[model samples]
Target chain A: MPDAHPPTRREVDVRGPRFAAWLTSAVLAVALLTGSGVLVAVQAAVFAVGALAGLRYAPYGVLFRVLVAPRLGPVREREPEAPPRFAQLVGLVFAVVGAAGYLAGAPLIGAVATGLALVAALLNAATGLCLGCELYLTVRRARPARTA
Target chain B: MLGGALALTALAAWWQRRRDGAVRGADDARGRTTTAVLEGLGVRPGEADLTVVQFSTAFCGPCRATRARLQQLQATRPGLAHLDVDAESHLDAVRELDVRRTPTLFYLDRAGTLLGRSSGAPRPDELTALVEAHVPAPGAREGRDV
Candidate 1:
């Protein structure tokens, strides 16, 4: 039988690192099937959720995909945890803060944490920067660069 | 997705923070006076910086916020300094920097090179970035006022 699935032309090529990014996102989505007060995984899921929200609510896809289209560039062989990596960092911090505040029964703290995280995330999407990335780079300066 | 929240944040949170007003025409008589007053202190290119000249007028509501933010940013960021020139005192600067908008940020490097400028209320992160890019690294020689 002939191959049922054939390669299709793309407006933006989703190959190489882009493909890895997409696949990792997909896998993360499947793994984070439950929100049940989960942390980092919930945010990875939030991107999926937010992308859908943007599609339905704003008629635009993810904010980064739309605004930073030029920066996304073509997929490469190397996959560095940079953009999503940073998002995960910020999101994880936000999750922890939120969880702690919730556990302590202080909605105010959770709200504050969410507020700050929102700033970092908004800056990333609008200004093409991630605060966590800067934080990560500064902290990891002493560590050896991973060959992987 | 993020933009949506930002849009809401601007409306709900930052709207009150925004100050609005038009730039005034120049007063040549006052321009020279400003330069003499601001010899050592730095200000935005074209816009003279005179700390003595604080610009808080009835017409300019966000003026204080802009000044505070500028002053606050200068504290954390390296070698970034600003001398505030009153929009009223130096109308000539208003004309030179084209301060057609109130609370317009006329940023300059420490030596007075006009690095970049924004004509509205600044985001906190944007303010940090502008300082990082424009401010002289600590211990670096200060260039002449550009």
Candidate 2:
């Protein structure tokens, strides 16, 4: 099958996504600790904005660009935006599920889903390795390559 | 709940760190899948003194980095070649080799023997050392033969 999404040429400073991950991890940690559906919902919205609205406009992206990027000096590295965007989508799925579970009184389900997202966020925050991005690549690899 | 997640995350991070870029000898379970896969890619055994076969996909960031590094290494070594295989396109080869992730690298010697394999972006020093050990210096083989 032809690639469903034509390759996007957009690239972002490599540090931007990592910075977002740090924030995400902290948010998820608080949500899990408090078992707060509202917190999970908020993070879900962040993930939704990131996956759908583009990273440049995402809240954490704005924070990184305005507050962090200025102090970091020149953009020494860049990466295509697709993988991390897909990762955001993956995080969104978990956050949404976790929110639903928490709000619906299924704390077990909430804990599981939220915990998974936390693990992924922690991986990205601490190591600059996105578990969601890795999952994206593995999923892509399982699909047939585009003929074109 | 938070403590459990933290513990799990810590364990995962430790495990991933241990495995990342660490080369291991070709396991016997793979049982000679390398030759057939290489041949399908138009490579015959012993064609190059050393071949670094890389399995990669389009969206993999580290795969791109690994490709650049391998390309640089190949450019510097007269007898070394780097082959980039689209893992998605070559599903059969990927399965045969049991490739679990992108940027899985197979290091092959002159006789096409699988020296080692590593999954994930390779460490620079280890990659360099592996290359030096496998690839002879310029005219070193010729001098030995003479």
Candidate 3:
């Protein structure tokens, strides 16, 4: 199928960093809700403050384009998706994992996993290599098609 | 950057794991260490007298079924084998083969010659006929797909 839209970049799309702050917010929120003691909550608060500080500085995309994406690795071809959708997805996974962990009394692990997922979601937003996208592609590719 | 690396690596690991879980049927993807599809199969082009290369996707259930079926077909048909390559990874190969759908089957004679192809789940009769026609009951024939 034809590309849904024409891509504009150096064979790689450099996305804005609104995603970074969003991820930090998501992770902090999960950590706070899942953590055991007051100290952990304080750490979450510190992260939130840091997130706010970063968000204030020319938005997150500036950080991503200037600092993050560069050090990650070379760009590769990837399909585009609505950016906010990815952020929301990251948030949702973290939230769900956090909740499940709390229920299972393994809140720390769940929260951490959720935080990790958020991190991945955020990175993918900037770099366009999210696990979800890869999963979708791998699943789609594995499923055989039949065309005459 | 560190966070991004972790994220990407986790995704890659998950991808590898998912592929690992796949059985040895259509586009197995598991144990496919090499990026090259043929090398992943642990087979060389010169080893088989006839080869059929199929470009496929992960979500195509029909492709999975076809792969399994093809695996069975290969057991009885010596000198014949198949390779399933991820079309996304090999865009050029897809274009070169003129594949338009998942599980697009490209056939080759014993000499590694591109003999024929089909765009869908081919019938057993069709595969057998193609093999019979191309190989022609053995003159110790040519090689196939690399």
Candidate 4:
């Protein structure tokens, strides 16, 4: 049989996601600091855009393309988009749960969830390790075998 | 709370630095012949002194870099072979081999014994050291450097 799966053809500069991760970390930090459900909700919307839409359409991604990419040197490396998109979905889940906890007057739950998201975003920003992306791979690997 | 969060993040970063991209001997592959697994993936174990089986997902950036590096190694090393497996499409082999993430590389000798495994992008010097230690010169019939 012909190769069933090929690497994703659409690629993004590695810097794009890293840049977005920095911005995400900052946003998540603020949300955690203020314990603001609204802020968490807003961040959730951002993640929703990235998850439901594509990473290319993410607000921070646009910011990177317009402002950051031009200032930096030419693209050094690129990567497939699926993993980060999956990461955004993961972030969205956390953000939604955090926002719900805050809105429901459960400060501890909100803090914990938002803190987890912040950690993940910070990891991506500082070290280029996407916890969500790693989770994505783990989930895929754990999936049941497709029946032939 | 914020201070606690930052400390936690720092701890995670430190842990990742210590763990990511380092190849370790595969305890799971110890003493087990992987000839069937390799054959299931259509790779013959006898063609080369060593075969590097890399499992990669589409979204993984380091996986691409790993592939390029392995391909480069294959070009330079006379008896080194590289096989790229799409982890998404080959879940069976992935599970059988206990692959956890993209760019998980399995080093196998000619008899299809799993020699080592790396879960992330490997360090260049360490990768070269492992290759030299495992893949003896073709047709020399020398024992492994171990």
Residues A115-134 of candidate 4 have per-residue lDDT tens digits of 99999998888988878767
Per-candidate TM vs. native? 0.30, 0.88, 0.34, 0.89
Tell me the tens digit of each residue's lDDT in model 3 across B80-143: 7677766666554454344456556656544444555565456666677666655434335444
| Candidate 4 clashes between residue pairs 3 or more apart in a chain or in different chains | none
DockQ scores of the candidates: 0.02, 0.34, 0.06, 0.49
Highest-lDDT candidate: 2
Query: Which segments of candidate 3 are over 4 A away from where they belong?
Result: A1-148, B1-44, B135-146
Ranking by DockQ: 4, 2, 3, 1
TM-score of chain A of each: 0.42, 0.88, 0.41, 0.90
Flag regions of model 4 displaced more than 4 Å: A1-5, B27-29, B33-35, B135-146
Could you list the chain B TM-scores for each candidate? Answer: 0.51, 0.86, 0.59, 0.82
Q: How do the residues A5-122 of candidate 3 rate in per-residue lDDT, one tens digit apiece?
A: 1222221133443445454545454445546333334333433333343322333444666777788776552322232333334444545555566557776665575556555555
lDDT digits (tens) for residues B10-117 of candidate 2: 998898888989999965545367755766766554767788888776667788788789778876676787777777776666776778877788888877777888
Q: Write the per-residue lDDT of candidate 4 for residues B1-146, one digit (tens) a residue.
A: 77788999999999878877787875553526454675678776677778787777776767777888877776656678788877778777777777787788877788777777788888888888877877665456654331
Native interface contact recovery, model 1: 0.01
Q: TM-score-based ranking, best first?
A: 4, 2, 3, 1
**Interface RMSD after interface superposition, model 2:** 5.2
Tens digits of per-residue lDDT, candidate 1, B11-82, equal 533433453221123355544444433342233334322121232222332344566776776555435555
**Which candidate model has the greater DockQ, 1 or 4?**
4
